[model samples]
Target: MRILVLGATGYLGGHVAERLRALPEATLLYGGRSPGADLPVDLATARPGPLAEALAALAPDAVVNCAGAVGGDAVALAEVNARGPAVLCAALRQAAPGARLVHLGSAAEYGPGRPGTRVGEDAPTRPAAPYGATKLAGTVAVTASGLDAVVLRVGNPVGPGAPVAGLPGSVARALRDAGPGPDAVLRVGDLSPYRDFVDVRDLARAAALAATRPGPLPAVLNISAGRAVEVRELVRGLVRASGFAGRVEETAGGSTRSAAVGWQCSDVSAARAALGWAPLHTLADSVAALWASVAGAPVPAR
Candidate 1:
């Protein structure tokens, strides 16, 4: 099987590509604007006509799109998160309609979920910001595209190789910089929001399953831990894993999504039923691994 993975150099995409490459009879191809990529494709600016020509040549059996902008201006987000998927779908329809297109969407697309309720895929998408709105646009493009496709709406991804742009990596960096100084105070924004955190490795495994599974699949599936945890817990876990003795003070200014969405969790039952997928790592495990990656040292076993 020939598989083309877009954004294969990104945090999530890299892991997905690694997992897919392990398949016994699979030929994994990287598709991106990166010079080293096998297929030089940039979804953000790619047009269907030219992209169709490229796709025709590659003739991939499956295309997993992990390209997206997590934090950017409206125009940038729309370009990558919204226009990118639409263009990819258009090109696929013209050249590789039979190829399965697995898109990585964001849990932010669901907006703020009810405090204790697990939001299902069927829940209405009411994005609180451009990031979620743009991601929802991408999700719509894939689900509405007349192709063998599935959208994996992922939650807060935490694990190794996590970039400092996200909360997990940001906290880890702060702790590492602070060292073991007891007087060091790590000031952060409000961390009272609840989030569904999933290990990046587990998410990659789900992507592999979705790409290789036979027959038709649901248009969308929630990929999450199925449990809403306080954001402070994740922060504290990193601190413990990093052995940081500093104080983490909750100050003003942080992620807008956290402030807007007080609670967010997903119903992952559909994923288990459809793809036999369930997260294997606990939040603690993810935290430990993240700290290990950032600190370059083994964490205390829990």
Candidate 2:
């Protein structure tokens, strides 16, 4: 199987690429703007005609799109998250319509979830911010592209190689900087909101399954832990994993999207039925792995 992975160098893409590499008889192709990528392609600004030509030449059996922007202005976000998928779909339709296209989407596309309910794939998408809105646009493009495609709507991913742009990475960074001092204080934004946190490795496995599975699949599937836990708990879990004795103070401000969506969870039953996939890592497990990877320290045996 010739599987081309875009954004293979990114956090999620990196993990997904690694998992796909282990597939039997799989020829993994890296597609990105980075040097040394097997296929030099930039989805954000890529035009359809040339991209179609490139796709035709590569002739991948599957294309897994993990390229997306999490933090950027409206134009920047839309260009990558919205326009990128649209263009990629157009090119795929022209060149590799038979190849399976697995696109990564965000749970934020579901907007504010009712406090205790699990938002299913069929839930209405009313994104509360530009990030979610753009991601939703990308999902729409992929679903309507008339190609063999599936959009995995991922939740808050926490595990190794977590980027500093998100909470997990930021907290890990802060803990490292603070050291083990009891007097050190770590201040952060509000941590009371609920989130569905999935281990990055688990998410990668889902992507791999979606890419290789035979026959038609649902247009969208929620890839998440299937349960909501307060963000505060995740912070505390990381703190424990880091052996940070300092205090954590929740400040007044944080992600505007978080503020708008006070609670979030996803119903992953469809994923289980379709791909036989489930998140295997607990929050503690994810936090420990994250601390080990980010802090450059082995987690103390408990």
Candidate 3:
């Protein structure tokens, strides 16, 4: 199938691009804001006419929007997270008719999930942060535009220097750029919140599958492992994976902002049942690949 992946340089989007590149007879189209893309698509600034014309040239069967503003002011976030997808929806419908719009959503859209309850796709989207709020707004706009859309609420996607959401990027950064102290220290903030971490490869796999989903698909799907992992445990695992007997301390401050969802465990049954997708990589496997990348060593599978 011919597919277009927006935000192709970002972490999740990058993985999706690489995965699609590996598949046979799949025409992959890449677009992004930066200069290093097959086609430039500035979601926050591009007009509908130009965007529609560009998309129409591709004739894509699926348009997976992975564009987002991970950290920014509410206005900036709204532009990329909300208006961006909305614009893309209109453009795709006019240009690439009959294309399925697969938008990547965050579990944070549900705010703080219940500790004991598994969050399903039908769960209320009471966003607690600007990021989630804007994303949910964008999802609503796109889906309500009478377009065939699939909003995949993905969990914490972790890999070597993945992105802003998971601990892998933070841990890898600290390990690489920390002070030259006596101990290999990895300073972090509160380690109380629990999250469901999925390997980026697995999430990428799900996205690729969703691109080729047959017939009419569901409105939303949760792509996750459905397991709660403590934040501290994630740090500890990274330390062990790095083979660094360092002093990993819980510091006072880190990122200035936090996600709406402090605890996230997804109910992935719907995705499995509908999309025929399952995670093949484990948490330890992700941690190993992350450390391997940070250490500049040959990455071995777990």
Candidate 4:
């Protein structure tokens, strides 16, 4: 199978491309703003003209759109997160109708689910932030495009990558900065909200499975670990794993503030039943692996 991965250099996209390359029978091509193994097509400024030309030349069997803008003003989020995928779906429908497209959506789309409620694929999407709203819009656009597509409403993908500067990256930074110093004070936001975190390798594999399945087109599936952990607990786990004795301080910043305090998780039974897929790593294991990678230690087995 020939696959085209958009946002090839991104956190999750990079993993997806790497996983595809591991498959001996699969031929992978990367499409992005920069030159890669394949052609360049910027989803941010994608119009039918350039998009059609680029995709037409590659002629992939599957197209995985992992491209997105996470944090920005409302307009910027809409352009890159929402409108970009919509335009790409349209272009793909015209250029390669037979290609199966897997869109990487976010668990943020479901916003904060009620406490103890597992957000399923059919859960109501009440996005609390501009990024979530735009991502939800992208999912809707892809579904309405009348193409062979599947939407994976993914959770927080944590793995070895650049140190994220926001709340999610705080624990990582704390682990990285662990040393004999005043318990390395690390500033954080609300730690009450619970989140379902998944390893990027597992997510990339699920996406590959989604792309290979024969479908009616435009199916929405929630890809998650089906387990919720509070931010405080996650921090404790990371601290224990990395021996990071850190003092976490709360900050009052809009961008770093938690959007909701409810249980934000998903029931990935559909993914398992349909695709026969399950996450190989737990949150604790993922955190340990991330810390080990950051600290240049051997990665533990999944």
Candidate 5:
């Protein structure tokens, strides 16, 4: 089987590519605007001609689109997140009619779930921000293309080697540098939101299953840990895992925090029924790995 992974150099896309490459009897092709990619195809700005030609020639069995605008203005987000899939699907429909397109989606598309409920795949998409809105548009286009496609709406992945921005990353930073003192306070965004945090390795395994498993995948699957873990608790957990002794302070971190899903959690029954997927890493396990990565030491599992 031949697979093409877009944005393979990025965090999530890089993991997906690594998993695909490790699979037996799989020919993996990676493409993006990055010069280090195996195939340099720019889906952000290029026309369909290049993609169409490449698809026709390669005839990949699957195309996974992991390229997206996580943070940008309305126009940039819509262009790269919404219209990118539209253009790529058009080319795939014409050139590689049999290819299965797996588009990476965001839990943000479901917006804030009902107060304390785990949102299913059938939940109405009420995107509260431009990122979610644009990503939802992309999913709609891919599913409507009359081709075999699936959208994996993943939760926020926390593990080693992630971008140093989110809760766990921030904690890793504090644990590594800040001494255990009264002045050692780590300021974070509003810690009131509830999030489902899956380890990136587990998410990579799910992506591999979606690409290579032998069953029909659901049109949409929520690949998540299925638990609404509060941000405050997560920060504390990371600190404990890292063996850090400090204080955490939550500020009024604006209303625009990207992954803040006030009460949104995921119902993973569909993902399990479709892909037989499950997370292997605990919060502590992920935290240890992340702390080790950031601290440049072997943070033994405590």
Candidate 6:
């Protein structure tokens, strides 16, 4: 199988592309703003000119869209997160109708779920944030286009290659910079909201599995670990794993954005039953691995 990974330079997209390259039965092609060794076409603005050309030239069997913009101006988010995937889906259908298009959706689409209620694939989608609303729109557009598509609603993916600003990465940075003073304070957001987290490697494997499966595509599948961990618990776990003795001070002004306050997680049974996919790393293990990367320790097990 030949696969094309959009946003090949991103955290999750890069991992998916590397996994596809490692597959003996698969050949990987990358499409993005800047062309490296692979193809390059701006999905956000291109009018299917270069994309259609590349699609015809490569004729890939699958396309994984991991491209997205987070927390930007509303117009930019709509263009990149909503209109971008819609355009890509239309172009892919026209250029390569048989290619399976797997869209990387987000857990944020569910917004803030009620406490103790597990958000499943069929759960009500009440996206409060601009990013989540745009992503949900993109998912709708992809499925409505009558193309072979699967929307993987994923949670926070923690693993190597993650940016230093994300949740897990932020914790790792805190651990690495531990000291005695106000500088050592872990400036964090609302520590009360709970979230389901998944390892990026596991997510990559799940994407590969989804690509290889044949039949009508599921509208949406929740890709996450079955358990929810509170933000404070996650921070404590990282602190313990890294042996950081610094005090954790929660300031009134230090909290997540308005869109990220409520408890949210997924019931991943759909993906597990259909794709045999489950998170393979424990939260402790994930934190340890991330800490190792920051602290220059030995690589942990995948």
TM-score of each candidate?
0.97, 0.98, 0.93, 0.93, 0.93, 0.93
Residue-by-residue lDDT tens digits, candidate 3, 236-298? 887766566667778755443343356878999998998889888888888888877777877
Give the Å shift of residue 62 in candidate 6.
0.3
Ranking by lDDT: 2, 1, 5, 3, 4, 6
Winner on lDDT between 2 and 3 is 2
Evaluated against the true structure, the overall lDDT of model 4 is 0.80
For candidate 5, give the lDDT: 0.81
All candidates: CA RMSD (Å) = 1.6, 1.6, 2.0, 1.9, 2.2, 2.0
Once superposed on the true structure, which residue ranges of model 6 sit more than 4 Å away at CA? 180-183, 253-260
Please write out the lDDT profile of model 2 over residues 1-302, one tens digit for every residue. Answer: 99999999999999999999999979999999999987798889899999999999999999999999998799999999999999999999999999999999999999999999999999999999999999999999999999999999999999987999999999999999997889999999989899999999999999999999999999999999999999999999888877889898889788965579899999999999999999999889889889998878774332
Q: After superposition, how far is residue 281 of candidate 6 from its true place, in Å?
A: 1.2
lDDT of each: 0.92, 0.93, 0.81, 0.80, 0.81, 0.80
Residue 100 miss distance in model 1 (angstroms): 0.3
| lDDT, candidate 5, 1-302, per-residue tens | 99999988887898898888989888998889887666677776767777788788877898888888776688998889898999898989889887888899988899877777898999899988888899999999888988788999988788877766455776678667887665676777787888888888788888888887765677899988898887777788777766656677778773463544587688988988888898788877777788777878775542
Model 2 weakest lDDT span, ten residues long: 293-302
Least well predicted 10-residue stretch by lDDT in candidate 1: 293-302
- Model 1, range 1-302, lDDT digits (tens) per residue? 99999999999999999899889988999999899887798899999999999899999999999999888789999999999999999999999999999999999999988999999999999999999999999999999998999999999999987998898888889888986988998888888889999999999999999999999999999999999999999999988877788788998677965469989999999999999999998998898888888988764343
Q: Which ten residues in a row have the lowest lDDT in candidate 3?
A: 252-261
Give the TM-score comparing model 2 with the true structure, all chains together: 0.98
